[model samples]
Target: MLEILTGAGLTTSAGLNAFIPMFALGLLDRFTNLVNLPEAWAWFSSDVSLWVVGVLLVLEVVADKIPGVDAMNDAVQTVVRPAAGGITFASGIGTETTTVRDPDALFAGGAWVPIAIGAAIALVVHLAKAGTRVGANTVTVGTAAPVLSTAEDVSAAALTLTALFLPVLVAVLVVAVVVGLWLLARRFRARRTRGRAAAAPGGSEWTA
Candidate 1:
């Protein structure tokens, strides 16, 4: 149960930043005894894989800070992030270091539940993040994109770290972020409606 929560937490973090949680997991698996990734997932901790993902992570951070580019990046990540979430969740859940003969072996027994849950959680959060970015682009004219992107990166990192220990907190934070984005979307739509109404030919105020 706790393992499932922890994996879910990491999946939520992945929705915000696709590679960070995986990178973090890889780093942890390599340097510390805190985690033991399955043999299939051991590549995530390899030097080459780490270096490659690290470079991509750097690129992702940079690209996400740019306004127009960030939206495009979000569109690309709409697929990648959720997929990463599934992989991360599956790897995390399957890290028990058990044999195929073990009845409790999650990976060996083909546990799809965590993978599906993780992907679902990630997709929802990804939608929230992408929607919020689109809303910011619409309302702020790209001025807020860098700041928001930075905030998202920080949030993803924080959530990734927290998921290793306090997954329940990650769940709460994900919910809060989703709700916040939904509210922002509503506000953005309302403002756009008002603006359009005021611009219409008959929308102008009349004088006696």
Candidate 2:
């Protein structure tokens, strides 16, 4: 379903950066016909909300670019990212005004389902991101901060745009994220295995 895909994309984006999707949704909803937010969510697109979220996004971006600060930011976002994902997913899908011309036909229920699903999706993504970040920071001695943070920000932005314009294409971003996370996880596991082996009774191990 396009509606579900839209939710998936938005939530996935949130997992990477909490405010990017929210800010994009608000701007698009306010300026273009790409999104028609529900009446109850009108405040989300208001000038006040936009400014507030924009500021928060700026702070988040700056903080995420530093190695140690990034880990702390991730700890803080453990709650924010999921909450943002839930809101975006629920709003994007539950309303029949976005995703497809006949969204009403596909989305007949409330946002609770999408919210739960979005939160779960975001939590998994958040954990993967955090785990990989910790590993990368350890391996690169904090030198990977800006590069990885920028990559995540760019990915989030792209995912948000795709979710808004072509909901069906969201699957591509999902697959990419899955693959990236899988590779990172594999590398992390290999490193851990090597660490354990090297510590075990003089197992053959070399460090460069």
By lDDT, the best candidate is 2
Residue-level lDDT tens digits of model 1 in 67-139: 8999889999989899889988887666542211121354445667667778888888899888878877777
Superposed by TM-score, candidate 2 places the C-alpha of residue 47 at a distance from the truth, in angstroms, of 1.1
Q: Which residue pairs collide, candidate 1?
A: none
TM-score of each: 0.85, 0.88
- For every model in order, what is the number of clashing pairs? 0, 0
Tens digits of per-residue lDDT for model 2, 120-146: 888888888888888878767778878
Which ranges in model 2 have alpha carbons more than 4 Å from their true place? 95-99, 105-109, 192-208
Q: Which whole-number lDDT from 0 to 100 does residue 206 have in model 1?
A: 31
Q: After superposition, how far is residue 77 of candidate 1 from its true place, in Å?
A: 0.8
RMSD (Cα, Å) of model 2: 2.5
Cα-lDDT of candidate 2 = 0.83
